[model samples]
Target: MKKLPHYQAGVAVVTALLLTTLAITIVASLFWQQQVQVRSIENQRLQLQKKWVLRGALDWARLILREDGRGSNVDHLKEAWATPLAETRLDEYVENGRADTEASDATLSGQITDAQSRFNINNLSTDGVINPKEVIAFERLLTNIKLDPSLAAATATAVANSQTKKTTAPSGPSIVTSAASASSVADTSTATVTNTTDASKSASNTGQASTDAIPEVQFLRFTQIDDVLSVPGFTSDMLLKLRDFVTVLPHATPINVNTASAEVLSARIAALSLSDAAAIIASRDRAEFFGLTDFKQRFPDKLTDVSANDLSFATNYFIVAGKIKLGRSTLNFSALIERIKIDTKIIWIREL
Candidate 1:
């Protein structure tokens, strides 16, 4: 009886331990769930706040662009809008519990860039046909970036194909059958009918068998810079090198003489060399190009054939790129802003 009581006590102790362990596990799990929910809510709040900040940044950018356009017809690096915002702490902008203690370390920085600084890929082709001059320019650009120059033709062909493709609705059944295919031609159920000859039936069958059917093709349009990857020769790495100097805009635009890089300048003007482009850039820094005449005077020998159609002194498209560092995370974004007659509009914006 004494041994039995001790054995029962031992079992009771084990049971109690098991129950305690289960209870602890349940409690811990519930606590963990609550913690996760709290964190999720915090994340949502942060995201909402970030969106508000982005909107404010966009509005500020628009104002700057509009004001800049209103102030002058000529845009240059010296302009206020052209200046980059350094990483400035947003502590003053944020509200914390106390004036001295900071809850989040937030910083904002951005820059306005001329999209025309790069070569627009849309210029490569026009209405399903390649432009020889633009092709040569793109070829030079590829060579300058140490990529195969042959890729330019493939790129142009892709762009042209995209433009040529028609988004036709589901058309009615085509007349795939030849004139001799039917055995009898009748106006209606009660109308007079003429019988088709055996020779005609044989001709129809022969015609179908002799000629192969041509399949219809749907080409992909270029909407963004990465669409170049659809071309046969473009690689992701090649794109990284080319991205700095090339862009795919909505429409064709002339290269901006005031903002184009040395490589772009030389490529744009076939007669101009890289060294010549470098010299022009050196002088351009000293003086803003008020017109094509100012640009022409820089390299008279090389720019004799160059006209207003090929180059512009000002750009309507501007890219606003910015970074926001908040707490442990950093958000980088770029937006395309278009300035037309003192009015600024955002074409597109993306987060990176």
Candidate 2:
């Protein structure tokens, strides 16, 4: 049969199948793209919600700190702010339906620590000048931590240099050279070489104009305990050892006797031994020092002579850290709070 040319019939069926397959593929791709967009939006919503919940937690901590300040003048581990908040469900803050029940599981836990518990590195210097006594204390701290005691001088120097703004000569020989050359009308290649040489000579003898000679080194300002690494002798291991016993505050502050560790107390008091510091801490545990007089009286026979100038029984700085776990995601947050006369201020907040 001239019957419907068999080849053409087969071609038509093949063409139809190809068209159907392509259409199905395009439809599936469109669906996938739409699903991805939906998930992206949901993820953004979840991030926003989580941040809000964290903010609320920080606010709660602020309130607690304020109340603590109002109730007492001293900061100790037995206080309410020191008590950690256990991991508690946060369903009221975030819905558990976004993810499977397992994924939706949410909880939060946190605690506030007295920042003054450690020796504030800022204490090493006063008004841009290193304090000899403070430096000695820092030296002791380094020695106690098994780190090179010499780092104390370096740290103090760094802090001192950063705090004291000193006039520095202009940097960049090239820039100085170029400026010097620009002063002369030397357009020729030969003149360019001569000009650069002359500029180098001028720069060698305070060549950069008085205007250019400004404070060039306001070196790196240390804001945290980790900044100690910037010093030449400090290593990560040394920092780990010093971290619990050291701190960096905005200004010079006395070490808190009620909260300071034995290492810190020993470092603060030149005559005090490590064992004596520990004994003082043990005695403090039995009863928190309500005042400087109280702290001295409560300690053993030797501690009565301890200088109260560099010692404090009260705390003004605190660090609050917490974690919020929502199913597959976890948010770790930290903040520094300053308490001023029954009122507290949030110095800084960060996500860890």
Candidate 3:
């Protein structure tokens, strides 16, 4: 009987400990769930707030671009839109003394860049045909940047093939006819030496079997800088180096003399010396170019190879980049805007 009482006490002690542990576990689990719910709510709120802030910045850009269209028909670095916002407090832009309502911790900084200032990759082809002149210009640009000039033809041909490729329905249970095949070329000139045939025919001339089919990804056209990833040999390093000098636009655009870099100016004008390009950049600082005639008279020597069609003093496309931070969330965006005679429209926006 004494042993029975001791054993009963031990059982009671064990049962109490198990109950205590179960209670603690339930409380801890409930607390963790509450914490997670609070955090999720905070994140959602911050994301929504960040989205609105970025949208406001985009609207502000549209207003500035629209004002430029109403006032000046030309685009130059001297203009207000070309000047960058130098990390100003977000509240500074809020009008009507709304600083108390806006978040003070956030900052605003961005710039409107001239899209036409860079070489357009789309210029590689015109009306579904390879353009010899554009290929030469791109080669010169590559050479100026210390990249292999041979990459110009291959990149252009790939982009051209993507544009002209036709898609068909699947013909079999396992596989079907694809729109086009894109493969590596051993020689740069094999695909574009004559520039007379279709992109597929050019691929065939490389001595690869005509019946050989390789998978290819096609785009209606290049829309962003990263779109060049689809082109063979355009590695990340190459794109990083080229992004500063090239852009993709919906339509062909002439180079803006007042905004183009020295390298671009040198490449676009045949036989133009780098020193001459520097001189032009310096001359623009003294006075803004209002017309091609003004640009011509300033650099008469360099004008021999360039025509009026290849040059411009104005830009139709501009990129607006904006970033905003709220709490632990941040949002960044790049928008391409087109302005024509007081009418401004956002063509596309890419979230970064």
Candidate 4:
């Protein structure tokens, strides 16, 4: 009986050890899981914080643009909006006037680019019709940039065809009949009237409004250069090179002579050589063109072939890019702003 008690004691000790081992494993697993959850929450918090900071930066940029628009009609490199912010810490923006304290360790830097200084791709069409002149100018730009000029026609044709597919009436018996009847109209005026009627009927059938009644037919606008991926012959490499000198805007934007590069100026004027473009840029620095007359005097008979509607001394569109780094996370913000009269509005914002 005494030997049986000793054996029972041994069994009790083994059971106690096994229970303790299981308890330790459960506790360790719970602790590890808690740590993982805390880390995930911290990462999400940081991401949210980064987004807020970028939004604040965008607001700041819009304020600057508004102030600039109120002060001057012309947007030049010398303007305050044109100035690039250096990489700065979040603490510097604090009202306490103390750096390296209180605020989190975040760095930011950004620049505002003039979107109107470059050629607008939307200008290739006026009211959905391909402009042969604009196509030729684009060809000249491609030639100047040492790319294949034939790509211009290919790009234009693609854009035009895409637009036509969107707006053109489908081939049908009624469409054929209308087309034939409209073709039979003898005089130009009668033909115009007949075509307008058919267009209205076609628009009604498609459930789209007829733009013919409007004085100006709205051309398609592209918000980003990447939107041109559908264009034929516009490879990524071609877009990269074209990006520096071309822009896609919601409306037809004229080239700003004060801000345009030599290539743009040369392409804009059929007769202007590279040396002439350089001269115009240099002269503008001395005395900026206050009016079209001043522009004429500066370039003298140089831009006779260029239309007055093709040039502008002021800009209305601007792009603001902001970068924010918080903790281990970084955020990039890009905004497109438009200045109408004295009011400035953000057209769109993109985060990268």
Q: Return the top candidate by TM-score.
A: 1
Best by lDDT: 1
Q: Flag regions of model 4 displaced more than 4 Å.
A: 1-25, 92-103, 162-221
Error of 3 at 156 (Å): 1.4
Residue pairs clashing, model 1: none
Task: For candidate 1, give the lDDT.
Answer: 0.82
TM-score to native of every candidate shown: 0.83, 0.80, 0.79, 0.74
lDDT value for model 3: 0.80
- Write one digit per residue (lDDT tens) for candidate 1, span 1-352: 4466888989999999999999999999999999999878767766666676778888998898888888888877888888899988877674322347535577789998899889999898887778888999899988877899999999998888888644558887445365554333324312432233554577697774533467557487787788998998888998899888998777788888878889999888888889999998898899878988777776688898897888988888988999987665578999998888788889998999
- State the lDDT of candidate 3 residue by residue for 1-352, as single tens digits: 4456888989999999999999999999999999999888877877776677778888889899888888886788998999998876765543322246555666667899998889998888754577788889899899989888998898788668656644577885433244332223324346576453675686777855565588666555777888887877788898998988999888667899889988888888886767888888899988878897778787777687777789898888889987776645677788999987777889998889
Mark the regions of model 1 whose C-alpha exceeds 4 Å error after superposition.
1-4, 95-100, 164-216
Candidate 3 regions with alpha-carbon error over 4 angstroms: 1-4, 91-103, 164-220
Candidate 4 structure quality by residue, lDDT tens digits, 1-352: 4455888989999999999999999999999999999889878887877777777887888788888878876766777888899989876542322255456667889999888888888788755578898888888888888888887776776556435333566885433356656666446658788998998889889999646565434334455877676766678887898888988777777888878888888888789877888898898777677666778876777967666788887888888888887767778888888887667888888886
lDDT of all the models against the reference? Answer: 0.82, 0.82, 0.80, 0.78
Please report how far candidate 4 places residue 113 from its true position, in Å.
1.0
In the order shown, the candidates' Cα RMSDs to the true structure are 6.9, 10.1, 12.7, 9.1
Q: Is candidate 1 or candidate 2 better by TM-score?
A: 1
